[model samples]
Target chain A: MNEQMTQKPYVIGLDLGGTNSVFGIVDARGDIKATTAIKTGGHTTPESYVDACMEVLLPVIEQVGGLDKIKAMGIGAPNGNYYNGTIEFAPNLPWAHDTVVPLAQMFSERLGGIPVGLTNDANAAAMGEMVYGVARGMKDFIVITLGTGVGSGIVVNGQVVYGHDGFAGELGHVTMVRGAEGRLCGCGRTGCLETYCSATGVARTARELLQNTDRPSLLRELDTESITSLDVSIAAEKGDELAKEIYDFTGKMLGEACADFAAFSSPEAFIFFGGMTKAGELIMKPIREAYEAHVMKPFRGKAQFLVSGLDGASAAVLGASAIGWELK
Target chain B: MNEQMTQKPYVIGLDLGGTNSVFGIVDARGDIKATTAIKTGGHTTPESYVDACMEVLLPVIEQVGGLDKIKAMGIGAPNGNYYNGTIEFAPNLPWAHDTVVPLAQMFSERLGGIPVGLTNDANAAAMGEMVYGVARGMKDFIVITLGTGVGSGIVVNGQVVYGHDGFAGELGHVTMVRGAEGRLCGCGRTGCLETYCSATGVARTARELLQNTDRPSLLRELDTESITSLDVSIAAEKGDELAKEIYDFTGKMLGEACADFAAFSSPEAFIFFGGMTKAGELIMKPIREAYEAHVMKPFRGKAQFLVSGLDGASAAVLGASAIGWELK
Candidate 1:
């Protein structure tokens, strides 16, 4: 075998989301040479989902010079376990909802024994940031993904922290509130950071505020039960008092949580990812202010607050592919 | 030089505290061959304090076959910085309270230029456990020190996480309760875990419980203003209901904190150290119960709760000495 031919110049990324399995062939510089997608939840089983994925993915791989030119594949999925390369009990995925799917091995086998790596999506984002985004050259930092659920990827001494069971850095689940009166989380717990800082959490807060107050605002024009974070952002953009207050409350809690996280790892930076960051200074200002106010004296003013530098459309796929580059 | 002489068989340990500085010469098996002590806060200057420490430590070093037999030295002190080997702004140490002291370098210079390492006491305990006690062969664990102030040392992937600024693992300061009604901590924070679970916090709990409730207990006979954790332990031993309740509150908070910690590192064990662990099952049971009750689903039933296996009198010294072994 020629060493040059075997040293593949590209890798594949699979961003396995609840609704879409987005695939991209990426190079060392994070360029997407070819991309494709499949409906993730439409498949009846894990095997069928992989079959559908391969059908869409094959042409994309061919566009990038076929199998010999692809070094590996990496998947970023909900409940993905890096150690075993399995997707376990991912509630949002129809194919992997109730059982552990050996997705990495399946992909590897179907791809002529090419190596495949898997990890929770947030960790992938962290790896992406380190490889090609804002967190480049940082040895210790945390990447927070704020979407339907809040997620975190922690880096320490330049390596992702995967604790004893291949499951660590679940910062979103840390209780931000203790005792009976706290908000209930989907994780069967009360007062998780996810309950207060997630995109869903923001909508929940908006609904609560809308129902509890008599204030006239742009959000009142929308159906309160169907309100989304996008709606909140639009409302806030129109200078709605109530919507702005909601961001304030959300950002404050998130900043406080980051303060606690600082006490844990003392990262050089905290990189925020996902839709909520699109709110920009409206959200970022409050997060930075609250973090500085709540963090311990030694840690205050030391950590940078950054947004994901990767292009929003391609970041997740790029992140997954970055993990592919790390495969041994 | 002969390899035997260059690879000296002993290490020196300094357990520098607010009130006293304890020194020990230890062999490879964690045995304390000789020991000495000196007043820590008595000196008006760091120079005088080092002078007093050396006055007592030299004889002990001589008894262990002189400085030539010592490979390195490690100091576990308040505000000790592992990267710089200095004590920085330690409020309890008179000489080090307002300034950073290069104690490690001073010791090395005075003691024939042997390598010296230093870190906060809790980190030292973690090193001790990894080298000579219960945490042997474990790559991920946390050691919580429950003394006048609560402190922590977090190990992930077989290395202590020092963070970006060498002040990570300040778990005691993480908020247990949010908002106005929480207790004030010495660090000027409110609702810190140290405010609820430290040895001092135990005494404070006893005072509050005694003052708030009218129920009669053996603690009422003691001067409330002067009560100590030892008093609470004694009362609990005699089956005092109020004292037992105090342990329940402290242990529950600690357990809950450990649960949060699990979310961070998913450590295999949570080890308790310091005077409070001496209460044994009185404290351990509540911590275990609360941890099991509050830990996230993935982490539940996965961690062990343990007390320090090293002897109380020598553990701190042993822990400090273990860091010496890691010195290059």
Candidate 2:
């Protein structure tokens, strides 16, 4: 639409995770012209974190013909607030855990005042899917990221729901189980969906099953404390009965939860992201079966559940960069 | 904004409940200029029901000068679908129970081709609140109606969430308790919020509490089968401990449910409507307290809990009429 927009064919995307901050200079087609990463938790303060980020990012910017070739930058981080372009009290971010960091503004100032946008990682993934991945052309759908924690990005009437506090899509925290017997969650809640459906939750479930039942499985060979979702997947692939049951349990809860979610926004599809989706049909089959069985009558058989279409390695960075395309 | 809009200064609001179809001709200020009603279940056919409605409506149409003075019509009915302007499978509507009635189109055809709109009662009430009640200027809020059944109208980013289907805001049916011990709901589900928080649910709670405990109260004088929510409210007002405890249980479940709803939309307010809200602080205090106690840390104390400000007698009709104002 503009001369500069056509001339500047790339935008910067920063996927700021607890372990690493990945930087990608992406073209409009989702092609990563250049990419780099730096350890995130090494910085003692927000200011120092941004300083370290710039050192790595400057070279990537130069690789893509300098800052002028980039239209804007988008950051996907834990607790990133789209409305204010700040990361607020993100527990896993060392520099932002206790204080709200105006990371977008700081980056914008250093990058010659180009527009910068920010949102939580899940929402960024939703934007990515909408822009160049599976959710393209879909006006309404939900992107669910099932990693160590479960996160959601809800789209209604073609826009992501940021809500009143810019933190609306916290579906993982919605109470799946109601009382004392429900598992304790990281948020200090009991019986949250994250307590049962997240990747870590799957491992936890595997541990519980291994101890509670005597069914022989490959998982029992591993040290119980060190069990991971990957181990469970491997066992399930090998037709381990206990591991399959664990997936059944996990997928049942996820499907049941999606049924409830349908009652809320009734999206056209539900896109799954993160490590848990990698279990493929072992996980998806039960999710579909449970969703059909549990969904309200009007919504039965209406929503499609699918895994993310983006490349797993670059998906986070692409998702973060997708936010840049919409920055004004 | 137009000559005809100024000339036709009124719209028709029909609150089509199971027992009564209350119709009102309202002006821009929510003033009822003319009103009428018809028994909803008296007719054996949808056509006859519309005939009965037209017979009474003609007089009101004349009383308001003429049909030319009315700009549009809106119906707030059980199972009303906004997208199609139809009442689909309304179980309590005797003539329309198993059929989809093009009620809005029928009204439009009968009223000199005037435009008409229809939506479920809760969504109508939400529109009413936005246009003429306490929710004025609010972009995001949830209106929960606790009557014979519980219903909700969810607003996000200034629009009522119609979802993929017209039936989006069914918060009444969201599962609160998820096991065999949970109450069975009219929707054939167990442990729905409606089974615990509706006016009928309040009576059910009263029966459960009275039968299970030996606590003395004014409600003991009444037959358990015939005890109404009104009786419980009166007993609670009279300082009956058991009655208060019933409110506490009902309020606690409702508060917890609202906390979950917050995870969906993070609404700025939760507006209460219908007969149960008449309990005033008896119910409101507990709902507010529990919401604050249970909501996510980011959302705690941020959302205001309030009662609907519309006059109870005209609220439903006003709500329906509000939809008329938006009809194209």
Candidate 3:
């Protein structure tokens, strides 16, 4: 084991996104030794996609010493199934949208039969936290990614909960508002947590606050149709009341959702990730306050609320890399 | 190992409830060879409680052929913690209400230092289902006990979720109704699922239905304050419209809650246990309908809704006994 660890000191990580597929060769300490990228939709088929990925991935692998020096490969993608090592009907991936793509097996077959694991990006982020980020020593915690849509990776008893169908931890779709008053979600559901707590949800709160009342704020200066979460954060940083209220609303709903999540798993911590977390204590404070106010009495002061520890720019690659260490 | 199994062919199960503490000597196939009971609050202290328990429990041990025949002991009780083998501040237990009682260790010391296991009653019920009932051969499922209070035992990857603090799986306390209009819960919260779905909650619903409208029904003939869930069930069985509507309302809420639960763990099946299940298809049908209607598209029609396969009279004892087989 010691000899093998010394011989193969790195693993290949692929952050497979809608627009770009970033590949990285990483060591045990999470340092990205070599990195490369390819346009994700450039290929029209799964085989062609693997062909393009290998074209760029090979140079990076070679830069870090070759196939023998790499222990495994791990891919993080939308609709990835860890149980099957396949990408199943991912809507944003043109090559994988209508079918199950055996991307992990394809990569392993091309790379001298090295082990490869694949899972959804959110679960990858959780593995990253457990292996190298804020959740390193924690066995039970939830990672909530407040990105384009709300995504969750739930860890219980030191293992990610894959459920019976390998499709557990869909906390984003849990209902917040249960009736006709709820906003429509991308999942074709009404009143999902994603509809109220995602980055888009924050922007929607901004739009609603600006439109619903005559209260004066800096957010009114931006084009209502194109306002983004970053715009809301900047305005809040400048001490705009409406902008601050937007974060309060978003954070409050998130806290309530976390409280409900507590009833399910009673995690020790809730680690926030993605663009909304950049709001810092601006968002976290309200979340903590609301969580304490809404959570059951026994769980009131038990959980720690934290932001992701990984650097923003390379977090995805690191998250994808972390899975490689868990392949066995 | 086979010889040990043959020599110790029985295990002791304790179903410790508020009113009574029932003990049973059980075999591997869930057959009960001997059983006995004592009033749970008969003694004033934990030590004395165990002393009284031993007085009744020893006879059953002798009836099963002697201490050598017993492999282990398992206890199913309120507020039981699997990690520490303690019952932490269980409100219904007079001797344990204000302190953490190390009940499993106490029992182990008395049982000739045999291996012992303890868990919350709902979790024990889940273990029972997995080991010898409907969930046999299944790796993931949720067991919901709808007695006077709604309790849950969640199974993921074939293990009970203990979480970081050993207090996970309090699904009854998850917020179902979000605002002031929601009913008050015993957990000092408003709008908990237990406030609307338990047997008491069903009775409360029946009372409200009786008082809210002048729609004459069989329920009005009885004293409104004295109405029980059994009364509602009997009325529903006799074709009472108001009684049937009460069940529909309760089942619909349960189904909606199950829908939200699906977004969390995505269990392969949800097994319902306890008094409320006697309504059978009247409740289960609406629960299934509401779950499919409210769950995300990917999860629709995927999970099974099941009733406990164990006989109602002995299910609790069997559930407790099943935990004995799991001692490491």
Per TM-score, the best of the predicted structures is 3
Error of 2 at A47 (Å): 3.1
State the local distance difference test value for candidate 2.
0.91
Local lDDT at B143 for model 3: 96
lDDT of each: 0.92, 0.91, 0.91
Q: What lDDT is reached at residue B312 by model 3?
A: 95
lDDT of 3 by residue, A18-93 (tens): 9999998989989899999999996889999999988888887888888889999889899988889999999988
Q: TM-score for every candidate vs. truth?
A: 0.95, 0.94, 0.98
Cα-based lDDT at residue A328, candidate 3? 77
- The parts of candidate 1 lying over 4 Å away from their true place are A1-7, B1-6, B51-68
* Model 2 Cα lDDT, one tens digit per residue, A1-328: 8756567789899999989899999999999999999999988999999999899899889988888898999999999999999999988887889998999999999999999999999999999998879998887789999999999999888788888889899999999987788899998878999999999999999989889888799997999999999999999999998999999999999998898888788888999999888899999999999888777777888899989999999999999999999887
Chain A only: give the TM-score of model 1.
0.96
Taking all chains together, the TM-score of candidate 2 against the true structure is: 0.94
Minimal lDDT window, size 10, model 3 chain B: B1-10
Score residue A311 of candidate 3 by CA lDDT.
Answer: 86
**What tens-digit string does per-residue lDDT give for candidate 2 at B1-328?**
8756568889999999999999999998899999999899879988898899999999999998999899899899999999899999988888988999999999888899999999999999999998889899998899999999999998889888888777788888887877688788887778888999999999998998889888888999999999998899999899999899889888988999899889988999999999899999999888988888777788888998889989999999999999988877
Q: Say which candidate scores most in lDDT.
A: 1
**What TM-scores result for chain A when each predicted structure is judged separately against the true chain A?**
0.96, 0.97, 0.97
Model 3, residue A6: what's the lDDT? 71
